[model samples]
Target: MKTPVVYVALQQFCEADAAPRQRLLEAGFEVRQNTLGRRLRREEVPTFLAQADAVIAGVEPYDAEVLAALSKLRCISRCGVGTDSIDVDAAQRRGIAVYTTPDEVTEPVAQLTVAMILALARNFPQHLAASRAGRWEKRTGVLLSEWTVGLIGFGRIGRAVARDLSPFGPRLLVTDPALSSGEAPDGVQRVELAALLAQADVVSLHASRPPHAGALLGRHELASMKPGSYLVNTARGHLVDDAALVEALQSGHLAGAAIDVFATEPYTGALSQMPQVLCTPHVATLTRASRAAMERRAAAHVVEWWTQASCLTPTS
Candidate 1:
């Protein structure tokens, strides 16, 4: 009998370092690697996954149409925490089990968020730029104690960021419709979105992408923020209106922003030219520890599904 095939659709990283793939192969499975070296389009994914027994997906879209096209697909193992890329309802309807590596990425992302917050507060980028040009100008920076940090969502990542930020002695405000006052973190007060927006000196986005089609932060929210406030987003790019953010930055409404994710990734756009904005190539969770943990768990999920004929779907 032919070995079952497992398809992997990772675009940015090398699968050669993927320990999970090695584990699967050792367990007597055949791995069909990426069909293309770059991110595959929606049309290309179905053709590749049609005969696959299992798939380890990255940020590629796995909607109802793509899910329906996969006749032999048994399970989808996500490399990271976010399920926004996959159609969960469709997967459930088709009886295809879905799993994610949430626990793997929590600490690394939390560390990155704190790093960006500090970098923004200290004007690190501006200082570096001036030093590179042979200037010795010392830039003034805001102390974390004097600032209020607002978290937009109170999930695992948000909670971890809150814990890390606690040591800095900054006041914490969290906004999540699902979280009641009783559920707020220790020393962190739960508040309405508008109140958080109005009071925060540094606003960090940790919310999941809602299925809606409009900007979560528009002109009004931006205007409501304190002048010279900073915005940091390690979450989904669509959560903020890029155009509105650019306008705020250009008009000096915001002090600066450190953004790790974008609406259109591998971003080549006007935002790249802005001096006040610090952009990372969506590598907040690219640490060796995080990568290894996520891959191992995702591989284990697939192995368990095959051996026990059951799913390991995480609730939350």
Candidate 2:
């Protein structure tokens, strides 16, 4: 009997922790991992995953065309919480089950969001630049307690951010379709998106990216924000329009911005050149514990699905 193959397409997996990959081996599946140490390009995906019966996926594109090419692929176990990279509807049509480790990444992402808010509030980038250049300069910064923060989504990550920021005493405004009128948590006000944008001193994004929609914060939305306020996004990159944000920063409408995710990764864009912008390489969920947990959960999903499939198949 031929052993079923599971391909690990995540750029970094099971390096510090081997339990996830070990579990796959003990489950009697041959496993393959990306050796390039980077995200696989769209064209390279099919070639690498040609013989895989399942894939432990990353942010690499798995659109309809890619899903159709992986003839043997039966399931995709995502290492983190976003389906933006995958064509979920197409996967369903192709009989491929899609799974994500949503809960495992919540704490890490929330922690990053808080850190970005603090960094921007205190102008960490400007301070660090002067210190690095051997010049002693001090920039006046605002206190979190003095500002009102608007959270764009009320999901697991959004709630976690609210919890962490509550003790800091910032007035919290939340706008989510799920949070109806009079449904907000204690100390949090549920407001419309326009109200939140207008009232917030720090507008943070924790919302899911809508499918096939334009940028959530275009020119009009960015313009509506409180002057000299900050923006933080640890969510999907497409939520904010890059050009619009750049314009806002240039005009001094926004004090600063901290961005972790970008529309195109390995980002070398205008924002990176802006001193006020604190850009991270989408490492919000890259903490050791979070990465290990997410990888294990994703691996377990693949094994569970494969085991069930094997049991259902007729013996030769």
Candidate 3:
């Protein structure tokens, strides 16, 4: 009998923690990792996981075409929360179980979100740049306590951000159709998207990619935001239209933007060129503890699924 193969497609997995990989080895499964040192190209995914029974995935796309090509793949356990990269419906049709470590990612992402908000509010980046250039430049910055911070989504990460920001005494506004009135936390006002955009001094995106085709924040929505306000996005890249955001920043309509994700990664766009925009390489959930927890959970999901599938199989 051939041993089941589990492909670890996540670019960086269990580098510090060996428990997750050890668990798979102990489970009588042959575990293989992505050797390319980067996200596998779309064409490379099928070839790389050709014999995999399960995959511990990252932000790689697993569309219908790729799903159809993987004859033996039974599961795709995501090391992170978002499912935007995967064609979930297609995987379901092919009987591939998809899993994500939603709980594990909350703390790290929320922490980064708060950090970005504070940095933007106090003009930290500009100050740093000035000091490095051999010039003493001091600029007035706003206090978070005096600001109205709007959250675009009220899910786990959003709620966490609200909790962290509450102590700073900011008026919180959230817009999420999924949450009812009772679901809102104390002192957090649940408002419509338009109202949140207009009233917020700092608007942070925590929402998932909308089901429709267009960006959640287009030209009109960006225009509606309070002039000289800031934008912080630690969520999905496609949530904000890149060109529109660049234009807003260029026009001095928006004070600044701290972007952690982009429509296309390895992102070299207009946002990068602007001094007002602060960008990170989509690493909101990349802390040491966060990565370990997510990797362990993702690996556990694969082991659990494989064990269940093995027991259900009829033996000769």
Candidate 4:
């Protein structure tokens, strides 16, 4: 029998941890990593994984055309949540199994969500910039306790954020169409999306990407939010209409926004130049501990599939 080949498609896979490579070698597999320091362009994907049996992937696109060209590729163990980047339906048709490390990202992302909300509320970025420039002024910031915190999605990260917000004693409102009203935990009121928009002083997006729907936070939705209310998106970036968000922030309709992901990554969009926005490089799951854990687990899943579980598609 030939030693199966494994491809590591994530750019930062081994930087935080080297154990994954050792594990693959111990399992009698040949491991190759993405050599390009950045994401591979669309044309560069197919040829890269042509001879591989499995791949530990990042947020790169796996469209139908890309999947069609892979002759030996069979599994993609995603290093993070949100399989939106991969064409799962297409992969399914081609017998290419997909997996993700959903649990590894939950805590780190939830922690950052809380951190962004507090930072925006207290003007942390602005104050730090001003102090650096030798200008000092007292700017009274809003308190989380004084605002109605509305969560759009009630899944793993959303519920985790709610639990983290409990000590602050803010009014909590939640709306997830997938969940019944009775499913809401105590102290969190389940409401309609529109009602939540009208009432929340701070709206944080935690919703998963809905299939075939345009951005959930488009013009109409942003218009419905309370004036001066803030937004924090550590979720999928395509959830918001960037053009709409930029206009809102510029016109002073929305007070500010803190975003970790973007519609297009390596994002050099207009939002990057705005003063009212705080941006991160799609790295809510980039903690050293979380990255190391996720990479190891993702690599393990790939080898596990090759050894004993290729017939069954493992849950991400």
**Root mean square deviation (Cα) for candidate 3:** 1.4
Task: Name model 4 segments beyond 4 Å from true.
Answer: 210-212, 309-316
- Candidate with the larger lDDT of 3 and 4: 3
lDDT for position 134 in model 1: 93
- For model 3, residues 1-316, the per-residue Cα lDDT tens digits are 5799999998898887999999999998899999887788889999999999999999888888999999999999999988888888999999999999999999999999999999998898778778878889888998899899999999999999999999999999999999997888789999999999999999999988733456899899999999999999999888899999989998999999999988787798888867777899989999988999999999999999988998899777
| Model 2 TM | 0.97
Number of the top-ranking candidate, with lDDT as the measure: 2
* lDDT sort, best first: 2, 3, 4, 1
Q: Rank the candidates by TM-score, best first.
A: 2, 3, 4, 1
How does each model score on lDDT?
A: 0.85, 0.93, 0.91, 0.88
Runs of candidate 1 with Cα error greater than 4 angstroms are 12-18, 35-37, 132-135, 211-213, 310-316
lDDT of 2: 0.93
> Candidate 4 residues 190-230, lDDT tens each?
99999999999889999988435679999889999999999
Counted clashes in each candidate structure? 0, 0, 0, 0
In model 4, the worst 10-residue window by lDDT is: 307-316
Candidates 1 and 3 compared: the better one by TM-score is 3
Minimum summed lDDT over a 10-residue window in model 3 is located at: 207-216
Model 3 TM-score is 0.96
Residue 283 displacement (Å), model 1? 0.9
